[model samples]
Target: MAKSVENQVEQTKVLPQYVAALVANLLVASVGCAMSWTSPTLLKMDSGETDIPASSDEKSWIGSLTPLGAVFSPFLAGYTADRWGRKTTLIATACPVIVGWVLIACAEPARSIPLIYVGRIIHGLCLGVAFTVIPMYCGEIAEDKVRGALGSFLQIFVSLGSLSQYAVGPYVSYLVLTIFSATVPFLFAVTMWFIPESPYQHVMAGEEQKALEALQWLRGTSVEAVKEELAIIKENVREKMENKSTPRDLISTKASVTALYLSMGLLGLQIFTGIDAILFYCQDIFAASGGDLDSSVSTIIVGMVMLLASACTPFIVESLGRRILLLISAAGMAVSLALIGTFFHLLNNNSDTSSIGWLPVVSLVIYMIVFSIGFGPVPWAVMGELFAPNVKSMASSIATSFCWFLAFLVTNFFPTISKELGSDYAFWIFGIFAVVAFVSVFFLLPETKGKSLQEIQAILGG
Candidate 1:
């Protein structure tokens, strides 16, 4: 027992630096998600539209750009991270985020529709890079026992960042919000200079001693534990070296192809379920659902609920496990969507009286809670775990980029989809997707509970 306690202490020594880097990464990631939240609201206000897009054609075109950027940027970011190192890739991507925000803040003054699209596309590109790279960094740095917890927290901070935007959006001008959003990336870029690069990247670069020191700094472990961790890392690196090939060779391999497909499927599920569309247009959904409010105060309740659910994720994730939580959350979302859809269906049928006055509001809130709990966090966490180190960056980029593509699809289509199908059918479509996601999680995803990064890699046949 005494020896075990000593071992624990030794294990903890390398954690401080890692925690610092994690926090920095979280800040940047949160900002990236927040920018997405803020952009739609700012765009609507700047455009002076009574409803988002104002027309179906306009909506589809605008929404399509998001996925277009998402689909492309990940490949670029992922390859870049693998080639240049995660730190450099992240720092380089921050520049676009800054530029995107500046364009957004200047939208009214600029009065250009093309500029808004450009800004959003740039923001989407930055998001694609940040999402893929940050998770890879966190997963690489974390101790085995804490990896899930740390990786899961990335989504939590993303929620926090998103919630911050929703909180501030109503109270502040679009210009101020855009400027504030841009500041986070700039700060993240500056601070990252002080953080150490990933130990895995150091190892890949053949800096064995530097890699050991990095692991030591990241783990906060004693020298002996550091050595043990170093041995594991070294073995993993050697395996990767043995299997090393050009990107084309890597892509041609069966395991790599399987991992890529799984990544893309996971991301596609995340977007197809309509969460981003819901999140981006929550206020509009609420208003359409019979809640009466102007654009400014429209989604406050939904945003608050989303924020609360996001806050609860870290607490529940470990206790419930990713699979169970996701299943439960997905089930809840399906039920909520069904309820909301029913309400809309009733309203569409009746139109004469307020028969289901409270149903829409109640159902929308329930939908938001369900989403925040399950689909929002779990997909990102799973994506982070699904790939091995050799193909991690490429796989994650493909997944995240696809996620954005789907996000673009859903967001762009929702307004028009909602208009044509009516609120009832549009939500039902999401409900069906949620059910599909639940099944996928149950059958397709492996139990990654308490696994080390290398263990996870081994499971995936790295």
Candidate 2:
């Protein structure tokens, strides 16, 4: 056993390989999130050159398709990862993203809108696959102590990608931006070819010896530690296999079902609060608020603020705990949205342009900061923590699907809602969602801070 353990340790010490995998994972996630930022700019550019309806309804429909793709892609990718393996699924997903970007780049200015939707749908599908698989892959490979920090990097990179779009969009045409963005996914796919499969997936496939070897290579840990982890993984797999239920079995138990519901609700709240709407359409929002602000500059600033807040998350997430952060952030978001809504309401009601002078900008900045600190990081991080290994993929898929679905609703309705309900009422609606999210976090969210994935699973199981 000692010799075997020593062999495992020696095999797993391939630090370079792991680092490469981490980089690839980050690239994949970055490309996924960057799409959100790029699409609006691209659409605006296309609108300028085309005679397409350019109506609110048309814009919303375009926005809605991507999330619609996101809602379903995860289920397909999750199962594919389980059946086909993470590395293969990631590579396959990359192809569509690359194709999407290339198609977007080649589309004629006159023919671009529909092609743009196609590209978004394809990209959203890639995002769904990448989002589900990347975290699970990272979780499986990460050292227990550093898992939270490493896993949290997904959001950080996502923020960076978002920020990159804002920074890059004004300087480049849509075609150039699309071409540049394609490199991320293309490189991610190429790099992933050199990485090892997730050891957990190896173990799930009943390839214990391979699992041990993979874990040793990926983790660079002692044989004893690898064996201990392997045992835990095997037991989880055994339980899953013995149950003989489909993924739906995950929520068959009341507790598990409640957890799933709450997780989905949390994800839904993230979208329903109109964070994406505000982020994607910031220029419009600012213009509506009567600001003479340059849309691109304001967007870049917002993106920078988001990136800064995300950067701070890893430092505090493990120490401060997930629940508290969620509540605080939700409360902060509520107030900010209320302020934004009130400003817009005042403007709409009395045409009082003074309220938008500085307050709207300040409120938006504050709201972005608050959102970045809490909801931005906690949702993905907690989603990583909430589901048990057996059902994690399925639960994540369902939750993510719900999230995208609500995102579709919010993005699709934002223009109409703001137009009819007025921007103030629209923001007020988001404020109400934040308030509800605050309550949910206080009551339902578990504190998974400083806990390993296995430890979190145990807590959730009870």
Whole-model lDDT per candidate: 0.68, 0.74
Please provide TM-scores, in order, for all candidate models, with all chains considered together: 0.83, 0.86
Model 2, span 289-387: residue lDDT tens: 766566667777777887788778888776787888888889999999999888887778776576357777778788888787788878877775676
lDDT of 1 by residue, 3-83 (tens): 755685555744565465565565555454544453346345535642222244644554456556766776777678878
Model 1 misplaced regions, further than 4 Å? 1-8, 11-18, 27-35, 38-64, 221-228, 245-264, 292-298, 321-323, 349-358, 380-393, 438-462
Question: Scored by Cα lDDT, where does model 2 land?
Answer: 0.74
| Model 2 worst lDDT run, 10 consecutive residues | 45-54
lDDT of 1: 0.68
